[model samples]
Target: MRADARKNYDHLLAVAREVFTEQGADASLRDIARRAEVGLGTLYRHFPTREALLEALLRSSFNALAARADELQTADDSAAALMLWLRETVAFTHENRGVIAPMVSAIEDHDCALHASCVTLRAAGAALLARAQADGNARADLDGSELFDLIAALAWLREQPSHAPRSDRIFGLIADVILVRHPRPEAPNASGHTGRQPKGRS
Candidate 1:
């Protein structure tokens, strides 16, 4: 890329980051171009599509999360490592608001621009979950695809204004359900009852 073209690309990416952070993943591309002081055609020339733009923006963060999973694999407690990775992955989805939809779609669509990154991320979480299950910490029936769905569900809950306050409580509930032996005891619910066991189990 020429110097000027590269400069425009960087500037557009920076502006898009800000816009997406404020308005979410579905924020208008035209707005991003306007904010970056570039023409819409220039933006399209660089990113081609909304998925392409999102892929460029999220590639680094996705890679970092994958790397974090690798590091957590060596942790002494498989359950703790899995929980930590889950928390981080959920938080990432929350941070990149409205991304879960595209991510889920990307995973099922091989030709999608974000498909590879989404697949890699899901695999990372799967590895953590598998390790915990093998250690008898998490439920054996659960799989990586289910884990990814849980992350997306948790993140979606946080996005709701009414459910945001209870997101942490729900997270604890979900975590407790996933782990065979509760890693950390959760406080009593509003009903003054301690955590409930996963359904279908004694």
Candidate 2:
């Protein structure tokens, strides 16, 4: 595209992100064009559909997240790396709150432009989960897709009109439960006693 066209495209995306975040995924395309100082034809020329525009807006974030997971896989502490990734994922979701609602449906709709990106995003999370599980950090029963849904749900909760700022605390607790190792049952000693012994006694 020409320099001027590229400028308009970028401007449209920035304006769309703001408008969508404020007004949700159903924000008017006409308003987006007005804010970007562009014509409806121009908006359509650059992004033929709302899904296309959303996909373009989110593609970079997803790519960065996937890359981060790849880097974290090589980190010395697998569990810590996964927790960090989970925090980043929550932040990403919070930043793109407007997209979360539609994204849930889009993820199931094979025809949506954002579906493929969501799939790739899930795969990245799955890789991190697998690494943590292999290290005996995360639970073995759940997979990346399930964790992704939980993250999305947390984001949705953040979007609701709540007076208390509890998302971070709740997210941390969730990460602890999902990624940390579960406590094992106590075993009997040689004397066949399961109760705890005195501190001074072995």
Candidate 3:
């Protein structure tokens, strides 16, 4: 790609991320172009369709989350690492619920880049889960796709009128189910400071 074309593509992705989060999946491509300060032709040249753009957004977000897992270095406590990733995933999915809903709804009806990106994301998440399981901190039965499916389901649930609180409790439930030992639960002492403290001797 030419310098200007590369610039245009980068601009489109940045602008699209903000617009899609704010306006959901149906945010206008024309608006994206306006925000990128580029022509509609430029946006289309990089992403042929709205789904294509959404897929790119999904891929970018998933890749970012994967990088975060790497940076977390979960070898110390795979459960903690998984919990962190799960929390991030919850936040990410919550913000992108609008983008995901239509793609999920239409998946049975069409071949979509959004679906492909989701498959890839699941594979990535699965890989991380597999590693955690191998470390014996997580259950062997937890497949990556299953965990991702749960996240997607929870995200959809959160989109419902009464399911928003589920978001906070759901990930903890997931961690509880999958981890071999429940993470040291947080406790607030009489001092009013809340965190884990070393066990006192009997």
lDDT of residue 31 for candidate 3: 95
lDDT of 2 at 51: 89
lDDT of 3 by residue, 1-202 (tens): 9998788788899999899878888888899999888889988989998888887778767678767867665457767777777778767877785755654544444576676556655665676787788888788977876787677777777777687876678767767887888457567788977755558933
Tens digits of per-residue lDDT for model 2 on 32-138?
99998889999999999898998998899889998999999999988888888888887887777667777777778999888998888888889998998998898
* Model 2, position 92: C-alpha lDDT score: 83
> Which window of 10 residues has the lowest lDDT sum in candidate 2?
155-164
lDDT of 1 by residue, 1-202 (tens): 9999999999999999999999999999999999998899999999998999999999999999999999999999998899899999989999999999999999999999999999999999999999999889999999999999999899999999999999999989999999987557779998887879778999
Off by over 4 Å in 3: 2-15, 28-43, 102-111, 114-117, 182-202
- Model 2 lDDT on a 0 to 1 scale: 0.85
* Lowest lDDT block of 10, candidate 3: 100-109
Q: What is the lDDT of residue 110 in candidate 1?
A: 95
Global lDDT of each candidate: 0.94, 0.85, 0.75
Which residue pairs does candidate 1 place in steric collision?
A: none
* Evaluation by TM-score, superior candidate among 1 and 3: 1
Top-TM-score candidate index = 1
